[model samples]
Target chain A: MKSKRILDALLAPMVAIIFSVVLASVILMLFGANPIETFSKMINYAATPRSISLILNSATTYYFSAVAVAIGFKMNLFNIGVNGQYRLATAVGALVAGALTFPGYISIPIVIFVSMLVGSLWAGIAAWLKVYRGVSEVISTIMLNFIAIGLIAYLLAPSMLGVQTAENVVGTPVIPESGRFPGFSIPGSQVPVYGMLFLAALLGFAYWFILNRTRFGFDLRSVGQSPSAAVASGVNVKRMTMYSMLLSGAVAGLVGLPLLLGAQYSFTVNFPGSYGFTGIAIALLGRNHPVGIAFGALLWAFLDVSSQILDLVGVPREIIVIMQGVIVLSVVIAYEITRRVKVRRQQDAVGKATAVAQ
Target chain B: MRRVIKIASVLFAGSLVLAACSSSDEAAVEENAAPVVKVGLAYDSGGRGDGTFNDAAAAGVDRAVAEFGVEVNEVEAADADGTPERAERLRLLASEGYNPVIAVGFAYSDALAEVAPEFPDTTFAIVDSVVDAPNVGSLIFAAEQGSFLVGTIAASASKSGKVGFIGGMEIDLIKAFQAGFEQGVKAVNPAATISVAYMGPAGDNSAWNAPDRAKTAVEGMIDKGVDIVYAAAGGSGLGMHQAIAAAGGSAKGYWGIGVDSDEYVLPARAEFKENIVTSMLKRVDTAVFDVIAGVVNGSPLTGIQNFDLSRGGVGYSSSNPVVSAFASVADGYAEKIKNGEITVSSTLTE
Candidate 1:
């Protein structure tokens, strides 16, 4: 029985991947390109040591973003505003860190702490609105995102928090080198692995441990499964909702730190966006499992990095986007089928045991 | 539930078997044919639709295709990962046997420097910045010289003593435009006041097409009694044209100076033609064409190819009849700039 459960868990994601590849082959053929040649070239190009580091760095950022979204998912809440939360937190934290000239140990933690605090506070507003004003979180969070963008735009002016550095670019003042996170060089590659990759690993472990081991985690799950049952069991549903949202936001805040401290050292106008939405997709694909999310993030990043080859082969790079969408859909369908099968098997086992007793 | 799972597993297995059983059909090779020279272009941020830089470069490629019958493949930078993606795109073009690869914009400076070394045989031409390499061509333009001519035109055309400059981003290249425009305005009318506003911060690609924000900026300038506005804001410049056209005071001599290509005759911008006095023609198309021509002729296309007033790389467009009246005067200044008798400041503070 134990081995069967493990087999089912492994089989579901595999089937989804196979289905996605077949669907993508059809798309490539439609575009008048050979799918076998394209996939072979992609695999060949992606296997390099340099490409591995690049993929790992991208995966590290995606992993954190996905974990943040998964926390909200566990409580049956959709936190779409991870985008705004992370950007605002990064901007504010980078601005503050730019003024300080402390050592790396002190300054890095301070930056991380401030980002988490700001992210939590921003998301706390949505939680408060939903709990007290009877507003749906989906609408409130989306509205808050636009408001945050406007506010950030206003603050980014030269007279405000922004400092113009080069022609066409205005951003927060530069953080001193002493306070920046130092990246480690990957063996046999020119690229360095992002220092915050360790932080992602730590956060992934914490996510799994908290959800499986803590009383608050149990309360959060109970509230998600059924609010009335949890109420009868004396769980504070409103409080659980607020806590889960805050936790989700705190994790989201760390999404940009890898780029900020390790790479850019300041929040430039070119700072990447849309990571929050990507996180939601990763969460759904992984079925909100911490270990599954790590693999999901890596796969997503791998496709993105490898798709540059298609551009050379006279094929548009958007084919990867189509394939990613198909994969997410197939995985969701496969998981549902697996769940139904498991339930039927458990019911049959119970009936057979009762017949033996009679 | 069990029945559904069984059906799903069967379907999944069936598809895999079908895919595996499919035989590979090899493409037939033809006899040796004439080897045609292929040119590759890697566009920055906004790519071809950007009415300013990239579009000008595309025009050059289009011209070459019409004239020389060469093949061209174009790639664009991915929005988020700028440097790595750019380098990869350049590398791919080189690997695919495209020679004399053209990378549009100064953003390709680092990418070209890295990738050009790896492909020592492929000729590379990068616009807006100089890269010191053996097989690389740096196509740069003297934007200030052209901008200075339009600045003079704007001052001459404005009824009010105030003119405005709306830039897409407050970067060095755009600042160079401001420097020349301000100097030209002040040179013609010493008492003229210039108001400058940028659309958004650096690194934000959306700023180039931010029409609504640009409209607000231009409207505010109009409210402040400015009768002339010069926009170097890419697609955002269209927003300024829309505002001026909708305001409809062109009969009172309220004018706009369009940047890059001639916006006066653009189909989408046809309604705003009357309001547009003259465009500061930054001939990126000419530069792009020149390099490809050099490659065909077996000439070394290396070092900085400067496009200034003398070489017709930059100038004032006389597409509108109303603006053509001052052409002789603009031409006189262009000759002086070409002769080194008049020098335009490339910096705002200068």
Candidate 2:
């Protein structure tokens, strides 16, 4: 039974992968593109030291985003507002960081703390609406996303949160060097891997430890599995929901920090947006497992970096997007089928055992 | 599950045969002797079909393909991707043996800086932003010069003695447009009240594409007695024109100035055809074509190539009949501008 479960676990993803490859190959052929050549070029480009570092940096951001969504998922909550939470947090965080002149340790933590506080504050609103106002979190969070964007749009104007940079590109004033994260070179490449990669790792470890080993985590999961039962069993369901939602939002707030402090140093108009939606997909693919999420983020990042080479090879880079979508869809279907098969097999074994005893 | 796999494999086998059949067309292209020069165009977030800046770049490449027979590959930046993606696109172009890789946006400045050093032999041309690299060609336009001409038209055409300048973002590039427009309006009618407002801040590129916001800004200006509105806000200009058309329109003497390409005859802006007085012609197409020509002719264009009015790189579109009334006044300014007699400031004073 144990071996069968293990086989099911490995087989589902493998089948999905193979199916997606075949489907993608057929689509490429229909488009008159040589999929073999196109894929080989992508693999070759991604194999480079510089490209590997790029992938890792992208994966780090994706990993954090996935973990943030995973926290909400564990509670059966869909916090779509991660998009707005992170943007608002980063904007406020950048402003706070820019005003301070503290040392690296003091300022970085303050910036990160402010970011988490703001993110939690925003997410807390959705939780409050859900618990008290009886508003669906999905709707409230999505609406909040737009509200967040609107708020930033209003605030980031020159008279508000912005200062004009060179060539009319207005952004937040650069943070002091003391507050900025120091990036280090990846072995042989000039490209500096984001120092906050360590932060992502640390967060991933925390996510695993807290969710698996803590009492609060138990209440959160109990409510998620069965809210009515948990309520009868003395779990504060509403409080658990609020806690998990706030925790998710706090993590969501850190999504942009690595890029903000490490590369941009200020929140420019182009402070990377839309990681929240991508996070949903990564979380779904990872099935809320920390290690699974890390792999999922890497795979997503790999596809993004690799597909860039498709444009060079005279193939549409959008093929990669299609492939990614197919992989996600097929994997989901494959997992569902495997789960049903495992359940059926377990019932069959029990039936046979009962018949033999009779 | 077995049956599903069997059907999928069979379908896959059928597609393989069909795919093999389709490969013949591409095979024929591969058989051709390699072209002398290969140009790769890396478009900004708004790639082709934008009917504006990117379309203008595409037009230049199309012309190059027809006239010079140079092979061209075009890549667009995804909306959600950032600087690293831009750099990766450029690197991909360079690695694939594309020469004179032209980046269509100012956002490519950082990307070009990173990629240019790694591939020193490759020639990179970036529109809008200047990078100090030996191999980089900065194809910057004197949009202020063009904006000045449109501003002159707005001053002449306005009945309310007030005009409006709706910029996409409060960035320096867009400010250049505002400065020129404001100066031109002031130059013609010193007492004219020119109300200026930006659609949004610099961080969001959607500011340039947001029609609703542009329309709202235009409506606000019109309410305040501004009869003439000039939109230098990329795709957002369409909304401004639409707003002007909704408010009594061109036949009723309300006017809008278009930007980038001549929008007077563009099918997309056909409904607001009469309302468009004249477009500020920032000839990105001419500049792109010229650069490709230079490359093919062995000059291999490098450094800053400023497109000003004297070289026909920037000017007022003469497509509209209403513009004929101000032709003489506009001509005087154009001649003076070309002759270096009247120096137009690109900076916003005040």
Candidate 3:
């Protein structure tokens, strides 16, 4: 039973991936390309060290976003505001850090603290509305996303935090060199692998350790499983909800750090939107497990990187778009089918054990 | 690994091309020296089909294809990953031996900065921004120079002194348009109030894509008794044209000045042709084609190559019948700018 439980966990994602590939193959066939040859070409393309490096860099970013979403998912609190939270956090973080030239030891910590604080406070608004005003967090968070956009827009004005450093760019001033984390470079790529890669790994381990080995995590999970049961067990449901939200938002704050510190050195106008929403899809794909989320991120990154080769091959980019959509849909579908079968199998086992006792 | 994939895909795609043509090159043995110039263009936010600057850049590639017979691979940027994705696109093109790759917008500045150093052998050209790399060429236009002419036309065509400027984002490039337009509006009428508003803030791609927001902004501008609107808002400028056309157009004394290529003639803007008084023409296609042509002739334009009024790289389009009445007046200012007698400020005073 233990081996079978593990098998089901592993087999589900595998089956979904295979299903997605088959669907993609049919689409490729319609496009007049041999799916096997195309996919094999992509596999060859992915083998390069440069491609691997880029995949890791992309996965590093996705991991932060997915983990942030997963935290709220684990608590049954849908904090859809992760996108707004991260964006606002980085904007404020960049504004402050961009203005001040301090030692790395001081400035780095300042950036991290400022980002988490702003992210936490922004998310706390929705939590506050939910707890006191009886407003649904879903509606509140979505609205806040737009509001956050407006707020960032205002801040990005030249009269405020914005400084035009290039022809078409208006962004916060560059972070002082002393404050930046000089990341290591990989072979065969000019772009440095982000120093935040180590930080993401640390975040993953901490997520696992805290959720499985800590008291707060247990209460949080209990509240997620059943509010009535948790209320009977002395868990403060509202407080737990607030805690989960704040924590999720804090993690979301780290999403932009990889780009900010590693590559661009500042948050510009095109700092990449929609990362927060992609996190939701990734978390679902990974089943919210830390390790699972890591693999899901890498796989998604792999698909993105391969699209470059696929672009060169003259395939319609929409075919890759379809494959991505299909994979996410299959993850959800396969998860449901396996979950039902598992529940029935457990029920059968319990019934047989009772019959043997009788 | 990448070389292997590129070669394999080329062969594979080549076979398909041969199959489709029916009578073309099945006698293929030119693998040693294909002799064709392969041009790679990576377009910015609006991509190829936006019918704005991107489409103008596409026109440049189309011209290069027609005149020089260069093989082209066009890649469009998705806004999701910003810098890294852009860098990867350039890297892919350069590594695949696309000798002279072109990035369509100023947004490619940072991406080119990173990728240019890596592919020292590949010549790169980016429009609207400069990167100080040995192998990279910067094709910058005097947009403000062009905008100044349109601004004079807007003031000349307007029944009311109140004019408006709508930018996609509050960035330096778009701001220069605002600056030049303001000067020209002031050049005509010093006391004229030029209402300036942008669709969104900088750093987000949606600023260029937000037509609804632009439409609302222009509606607000029209309500303020403004008679003419000039927009450098890329795809979102279509919203401005739509609004101006809907709000009584030239019949009600409302006009919109276009940007990049002539908006009056673009199929996408045909319905709004009556609304477009004139366009501030920035010949992006000419710049793109020039870069490709230079590479073909082995004199790749390197460093800050300014395309200005003197070079006829920037001008005012007299496509609308309304602009014909004001054409010579606008052209006089264009001549002065071309001679440096009338210098336009690229910086906004307000």
Candidate 4:
């Protein structure tokens, strides 16, 4: 039984990968592109030092975004507002940090604290609506995403928080040098690997530890499993929902810090948007597992980095996007099939034991 | 079971967003024999079919392809991908032997600055923004000079003595256009009230992409007795054109000034072309063609070569008949600008 569980775990992902590859190959041929050459080039690019650094940097942001969504997913909550939460948090965080001067330790933590506070507050509105007014989170969160974009659009203008930073660019003023993360070289790449990479990994560990080993985690998961039963067991399901939403928003606040601190040192009007949607995909891709999410973020990052090479090889770079969609769809289908198969085998094993005894 | 359905629905919505945003058409161009000079155009977030900035850049490359027979490989920058991804695009082009990699927009400033130093042998040129590298050639336009001509037309054609300027972003590049337009308006009519407003801050693509906002601003100005409206907004500039045409074109004495390419005759803007007065031609196509021509001719034009009015790199279109009435007045300023008699400053004094 133990070996079967292991096989099921490994087999599901492998099957998903093979299915996506076959589908992508057929599409590539229709576009007049050689699938073998395109895939080979992507693999080759992935092995490069520059590609390694780029993937790690992108993965850092993706991890924060994924974990934030995963927390909500565990409760069956569709926290589509991670984009809004992070943007609002980062913009406010940067604005506050840029407005003040402090040492590295003092200022960085304050910036992070402000980010979590703002992000939590942003998500709290949705939580309040869900618990009190019976508002569906999906609808409210989607609306909040637009509100967030409109808010950022207003805040980043010159009359408000914006300042001219480059020839044709305006952005928030630079954060204090000491307050910024001093990223280090990763050897073989001109671009330095973000120092926050370690933080993202630590976050993964903490998420695993807190969700698996703590009492609060127990009540949270129990409510997630069956809210009515948990309510009967003396768990305040409403409180648990509120707590998880806050925690998820807190995590979401850190999504932009890697790039904000490690590279740019300020929030430009062109501050990379759309990671919140990518997080949803990663959360689904990882199946809400800590280790699984780490691999998922890396794969998504890999696809982004590898696609750049496709254009150089005279192939449609969008082939990577197609492959990603296919992989995601297949994984969902593959996992469901595996779950049914495992259940049937367990019932069969129990039936044989009873028949022998009779 | 419900969870499965919910997940499927979310995936469907996500794919729809992807389909709407992705520009995957017009894939790869295969050239059998290696051409003498290979040009790789790294388009900004707008990509190929954006019908605004990237399309204008492609026009120059297309002309180069026909005349120089140079092989071209095109790559587009994805939205919100950050600077590293942009640098990677340039590096990929350079390492793969693309000689003169042309970055289409000012947003590529930081990315090109990083990658140009790594490939010292590769010749890189960026439009609109200046990158300080030995091999980098900044193809800047005297936008202020071109804008001055439109300002003249806007003032001469305006019977209400009210004009408006809508800038795409609050950046210096667009500001130059604003400054020239205001100066031209002031130069012609001292009593003219020129209201200026920007869509958003610089580096925000939405500043150029938000047509609804531009339309709203234009409507407000028109309600305030403004007869002429000029928009330097990028893709969404069409919305302002639409608003003007709907408000009653030449028949109602409403005139809209077009920017970048001559929008008077563009098929996309043809629906409202009759409403368009002379468009402020920045001549990006001419500059792009010249850079490519230099490479093929073995005399690559380097350094800060300002394509100004003297060389005919900047001017206005007289495609509309209404513009003919003010042609003599606009041409007088054009000659003055070309002869340095009427010096236009890129920076706005007021």
Question: How accurate locally, in lDDT, is each candidate?
Answer: 0.80, 0.81, 0.82, 0.83
Ranking by TM-score: 3, 4, 2, 1
The residue pairs that clash in candidate 3, if any, are A269-B203, A270-B203
Cα lDDT tens digits, model 4, A1-358, are 9998667666766787788789889988998778897788889998888899989999999999999988888877888899888988898888888877788888888888899888888888898899888898778877887787678767887778888766566778878888887778878888889999999999999999888999887787788778888889999988988999889989989998888888777787678877887888777778778888898899989998998988677677667777777677777777878778878999999999999999
Better candidate number, 1 or 4, judged by TM-score? 4
Interface CA RMSD, all predictions: 9.2, 8.4, 11.7, 3.0
Per model, the share of native interface contacts recovered reads: 0.18, 0.26, 0.38, 0.32
Which model, 1 or 3, shows the larger lDDT?
Answer: 3
Q: Candidate 3, which CAPRI tier?
A: acceptable
Error of 2 at B309 (Å): 3.0
Candidate 3 residue B107 Cα shift, in angstroms, is 2.0
lDDT of 3 by residue, A251-327 (tens): 98888888887788777777887778667767877888999999999998888888888877676555655666666
For residues A1-358, write the lDDT of model 1, one tens digit per residue.
9998778776878887888889889988997889999999888878887678778888888898899888887887778788778888888888978988999899999999999998888889999999999887777877777666666666776668888643345678989998788889878766677889999999999988888899988888787777899999999989998999999999988988887887666775556766787787777777778889999999988998887777666565667766676677677778877777878999999999999999
Residue B27 displacement (Å), model 2: 18
Clashing pairs in 4: none
Q: Give the TM-score, chain B only, in order for the candidates.
A: 0.88, 0.88, 0.88, 0.91
- What is residue A215's positional error in candidate 2, in angstroms? 0.8
Among all candidates shown, the one with the greatest TM-score? 3
**DockQ-superior candidate, 1 or 2:** 2
- Candidates in order, TM-scores: namely 0.77, 0.84, 0.90, 0.87
DockQ of each: 0.17, 0.23, 0.24, 0.35
TM-score, chain B, model 3, is 0.88
